[model samples]
Target: MSGGQTQEQTPEAGTTETTPKRLPAAGRGGGGPHFNVGMPGEKSMNFLPSAKRLLGRLRPYRAHLMGIVTLAVFSVGFSVIGPKILGMATDLIFSGVVGQQLPPGTTLDQAVAQARAAGNDTFADMLASMDVIPGVGIDFTRLAQVLALALVLFVASSLLSWWQGYLLNDVVQRAILRLRADVEEKLHRLPLPYFDKQPRGELLSRVTNDIDNIAQSLQQTLSQLLSSLLTVVGVLTMMFVISPLLAVIALVAVPLSVVVTKQIAKRSQRQFIAQWQHTGALNGQIEEAFTGHELVKVFGRQREIEATFATKNDELFKASFGAQFISGIIMPSMMFIGNLSYVAIAVVGGLRVASGAMSLGDVQAFIQYSRQFTQPLTQVASMANLLQSGVASAERVFAVLDAQEQSPDPAEPARVTNPHGRVEFEQVSFRYEPDKPLIEDLSLVAEPGHTVAIVGPTGAGKTTLVNLVMRFYELDAGRITLDGVDITTMRRDELRGEIGMVLQDTWLFGGTIRDNIAYGDPGASEEEIVAAAKATFVDRFVRSLPDGYDTVIDEEGSNVSAGEKQLITIARAFLSNPSLLILDEATSSVDTRTEVLLQHAMAALRADRTSFVIAHRLSTIRDADLILVMESGRIVEQGTHSELLAAEGAYHRLYHAQFTQPVAEADGGDAESDVVGASAVTGTLRPRSPVG
Candidate 1:
């Protein structure tokens, strides 16, 4: 409404592609397109402050996170000890064997046994004793001490790892649990237009598949990543201490691998983003097919649907393989580079030791450090896809969460007490699209205990009026008054509470029939619910069900017929006992028998309340009240059926063409029969008293 556009039928929403149409960041880090590389997605590109806001959720659980960090440190600390001890063993065995070929005061067999025993000591003890005496030959006791501590560290690593898993599981699961609930609540609170814009599959992906990614990434993959990182750090530190030259030489592989990894990961990230989008499109196709299966079968579009699915499925498969193939190449390549680095170190360090420039112990420690550095790097490189994919999913989620909310009602809201059901449209006009008013300068009034029937073509804005009555969409001009109080000033929830609406589509959740009858009015007693059901004629057929009121209804009430679904909706409206009732195509799809029953039920529901009926059947509301015959967006004629028929105007032509079907002569002579499709009233009309 704020924009100057004459008509904006499909308004773009949320942080959409508003930038100067970024020409898909040239293939592979500006490599001029031949390399077939993909650009990094919005992850490292966008600034989403809402994500930073969501991080506040982690604050309360900081203590638990700190503990996880400590446990990880301890676990890595223990894990690194094993390799360090092996290096010490190597050094002790190599030193003991050189020149002397054993330890002091011992034969070959005795010296070998003593050296082996010394290699088993704690490395710390070995270092301490070595510091005490320069050039001391060998000590089997120190080696023994290092080996014993290494064994203890290995066992401790295992214990700490188990604890890490247990605690991480509890924390991540609970975090996701809270997050899911919060998201669901937000979904409920968001405006209806938001749902209309987003595809059902995309929304479903957020609730289902997207959350699943978060769980896997945070729970298992993240733990592996963290531990691997720590392992790399610990090994690198020790390697540097052993020999800075070797440490620097071995790390050539690390930076090179990271550069390569970043390139490959970018491609993989794009592929994964494509994969998720394609998956959603595929799911959308499937859902659309299933929902409209009846129409599809009737129209014989099964082959067409299948072809659509196959095309989407192929795209999904290609995306999946492309992403996995790139990500999969990283680890093995890292390992290859790692092996080459090891060979380089083995050659270079062997010479340094032989020349007595570096100790054999130092060379061993350098190799140990190399593994520590390489391992976590490899692990991180491999996890690049998961991390990026998670970010892609986050972007989609934030897109939803960041959408502008519905406009709120005035702070000083008006209230209607024991409303008389009198409604007046005071110069009311609405435009879902700007300047293309659906209901232009529309004005009408419904008196208490009177029926106001609106008859119009499919897109004539008939349903829009009903929606406005319920305040589902705000009006663009003028005010709608309920019992002389401005509807806009009233709290939306309160305003809706006084109106009962029967929509074209009848929705039922998975629950007992009784439960659905009391859906919004859950405080109602079963007896009251049954009474309402009977009043709506739902009780008539529900009694025939296997379990009657207790029947376990499937979600969407899929187990029921269109007629029964309609009756259920009517029953729900009856239970509400609102002051104003609206029926939009209430019995459009029902058979004559069900329509009659629905008519009677609606009569009961409308008793002592003003009602608005968007009808296609003239026989349903022929007894009395006014009819507003709509053409395009305006009310062209208004009057009772007989008066309009007598006047021979728009209502008359419509009545003859759609509603006035000849029926078997009743006791009062000829009568009009009910028919849904033939209920069209002409677009033009003659003037008459607007109300019966």
Candidate 2:
């Protein structure tokens, strides 16, 4: 990385603070804490932008979305038409029976005589035009027919809505599937620093739970929003047609409801955001605790862990309760306002009816429209939470999707072929963070067929050097080359293919023993796999298993002993047959006998091949062709063991501190192992082929 390049700043991930952080306005909008029910530590999303981006994602499904919306309009339209038609039937029944009553002071017989005189054919019509009794004069056949037609419209409307939901599901789910796949692929492209800052569970939640929320809200709310909006529009149109005065009064409630809902919604947004943030924090805690349950139990810190969990859980609860409670009142509050509007409409319409300015049927229809108008208002209020929550989740998912990717590969990468295992660090400099430089002006070379040992105390930048060789990170200012060609010019894949590594922490995937060994060279033949295993002495124990090489290894190869895991990794390296090999504490986890066997096996593997061995045990690398002593990332000393001992420099002091005391104990008094300088008590040694 160039020194001028800087790390991108983001919200401090995995913060334990219960209070939500205020995001800056430049990247994510800066606002006061917003509520999201049960979600804690989640960033408050820019609703308009996130929704726009979300809509952009649904562009491919425009036709399906339009169809769902159109169907929703029709469904609500048909539902709205039902009551009016029923009211018409009510008028017809009232006229047919109740309106047929004899006029005051006139007997039924006198009305019948007048009707008969007009002729029997016109008599029924005459009777229907007259007043009789309220509701008693209803035409049973007509009433039943009207009710039956209403049922058919309702059923048809229901079926259409169901079909619309099904189509919406297909469209929304497919979009979500693509999004999830993108997130998974993005994980591989993200830089190491991204993972260092973010928790794995947080990323998982973004990929899994957040995207799922968007899909679910799309499925449920999309149709409902469309229908509710149409109903509002339809009810308003009907209300104005019935009585303009009453419609105006009913309209009064809308603004009041909106004002109330807006205030509540604003407060709820912060609560909802806090809820999700706390939820993510809680999940991260659980994941960390579970992964290290053994360590926690060993340390007897159960109570402390429980108390931490309780704190997180309580934060989550308070946030969720706040969000739900605030949002929960929207519907009831709108309903109460609606009732006030209903009373106002009724009183005004009653005066109009008495003054003969409006008919009873018109007043009734107006009342029905008023009720219908308020219902969609309530829905709109409730949808505020769903829409905001869904948008919040979408913003998180998009954040991951839009994260910075790794540096792009060269357009035309150079190929490394038949590499001769020569690696050199030329005036190298690097730092994980800007202010702290880890390595400065580091220069070193390892030639083919030489065992180069790197010895240093912990955090001496030993592993950092190995990381540079493998190009896990970019150099700040340096040129690292393989066989005199700058490695950066070559494709990373081709370069890594020429090197193999075995680390102190063994990594074995969940697979059969054969598969784990063959992971490096997937196309390796069975004979090759077994030969590699035999060379590493892995075959000795593998043959004793009931399934032999075919036995399955549990996750991280926990079913196998640490020694066994190391042996398997060594076998994997053997199968790769790389020109250069790296061994980092390869024998540290094994017993004394196992260590002796592994050391011999490793020595044999290193023969006639360039190797870099990082070791804390000085005795293990006594026969190394060259030893490089490192302190704080700089090479302080370099020479053969005897040459460095004679110089009495850094290497000599380290050797004395580690090996000399042990040798004195093994011998009676003098530190002698082979009639040499402290060598006689240490162990048998080959003649010193000193290099200075």
Candidate 3:
């Protein structure tokens, strides 16, 4: 089942149940990391993973990332040099004052003339040699030199911007693509049972939303961190070299900022983790509604659905708001601290300048450097919130990637060849949970081309038996065999290829009817598809439609009637032409007329095909080669209809009591009763139960 977006994807996008020729092995899909088994909710978490571990994905593009880093460094260097030149100009301007030294143009010639009138020979003589130049007049070349350095720094800064932007963007995109593919592949590898505990929305969030956050983190992490670090270091160097006193004062507030940052980051990280979990729950509610809308309507659960959805929706809102709120405060708080430090540095620098202990230029330069130092520190602190979220997201992603495969399967899968329809259950047993076994000491055999029928009440392990044959769940004891070979030894794909199944619940993909039929036999020709359709009674209904086989069905074949869906699935099986077939309640939903038609069609298709029927109506399976009656995970009795009826045991009582009941039909006619007045035998009959 899918949403409105399903229209865009392939109709057969969901299940890969098909007749793919068995390969030597199944690909784990990608060579990327698995995020399952132990990561997110696991006991063993690698919280402090090595730098090497974090950089694993970037290893392939090491050269490219290095180029980006280099550009970032160059860009920061240029930007950092701008303030230095400004400070140098300031120093040069004031150094000549206090009679420190004359740098050609510092003292105006007019001022020197006044000093000469006052008999100040040193100042006047220094001004006499000053050569006038354009722009600032005397000594224009030195001023030009300062402006040229500024231009060089500006150009370097721009180039660094372009390079870092391009490189970081490319790296982030590639990383995200690989991560998506890996997550998708791992989802496919996960066993069906794993789905029983996990919700679809949570899984989707890990792949789509959470991984996206991680990608964003990767995008900013390298360029911003490297540049910020370099800027901080450069600023600190300038501050220390200019005036150690002011530098010491500027450093005072850093520890306080670090402490506050750590506290905020911890809160943000926790909130982010909660946000993802709540989002998944909300998504699951939506998915469940869309998939089971019809069931909801049938059960008259509109109010219940709304209540459930609203609860999850509220939880998501609170969690997301909390996360954003906490993350939002980090930047302002960091800026506040930086501003406070700025005021302190300015006040302390002013005193040093007033006492003549430092040049006004040195005081100004120290204040400028102090600001430069705080800027990067503020940024790194603010961005730390986003980075923390990356950690939480990575934790979920790694959980799925780390799951262990069910069993030790060959790296190169071995394919089965020329399978016969023969199957035997050799004292097989199974249990999904330790306390409750679904099947026990079950033994049976179906020879080639034989039709075996199993009938029982619900929970009788009826469905569990067929699942064992398919190895959907592992066997707890004993073994099952196909053509005298241990079934597990033959590769899952090869063995599954030889078996065809028609489930009671019809799930169709979005596609033309012909494509749907071909899904069972990927190579089936149009002729084979049509023939199979005719054999399964789907052709009769299909031909009546204007488009016939060309008609497209909605997802899960929701466009068709239930019986039509069942017949189409049956057609799929017929097209596959597998030697063995499992008809799991094929007639459960259809009216008696359609049931009768399906029965005849099934009979014709079963010729030369080994078939197993999990039948509900006793009369429908009377002629089966063998009948099995199961109870409480054990087969209580089995025989031909007459033989079981004569025995008057568990099977005899269950069949006649459950299947023999009759009532007037739509035409007000009495149907022939299946029971020979034997419902009273061994109390009421318990219909054959589905295998666990």
* Number of clashes found in candidate 1: 18
Q: How accurate is candidate 1 locally (lDDT)?
A: 0.70
- Residue-level lDDT of model 1, residues 213-274, one tens digit each, is 76776675658887998888788777777788888898899778988897888678777778
Worst 10 residues of 1 by lDDT: 19-28
Q: Runs in model 1 with CA error above 4 Å?
A: 1-57, 95-144, 409-412, 659-692
Whole-model Cα lDDT of every candidate shown, in order: 0.70, 0.74, 0.69
**Model 3 Cα lDDT, one tens digit per residue, 227-327:** 88988877787778778888888898789889988888777766777777667556655665666667668878778889877877887788788888888
Question: Tens digit of lDDT per residue, candidate 2, span 1-692?
Answer: 10001111212233343433311111111111221111324456578998888878888988998898888877887778776767666666655554445465665556656667777634544344444443244677877888788788888878888887888888888888888888888988886556544554556677777788888777767777778899999888877777788988998887899899999998898887777666776776676566566666887877877887899899889998998899898988998998999899889887775554765567777888888899888888888888878887887787787878878778898776667788888999977656666679988889888889988655567766776788767899988988777888887778889888887667788899999999989999999999999988899999999999999999857689988998899899999998789888777767778888877877777766789888867888888888998887688888888888899988876777565655444554444332353443245453455999
Regions more than 4 Å wrong, model 2: 1-44, 103-137, 140-145, 350-364, 607-609, 661-692
Using lDDT as the yardstick, the better of models 1 and 3 is: 1
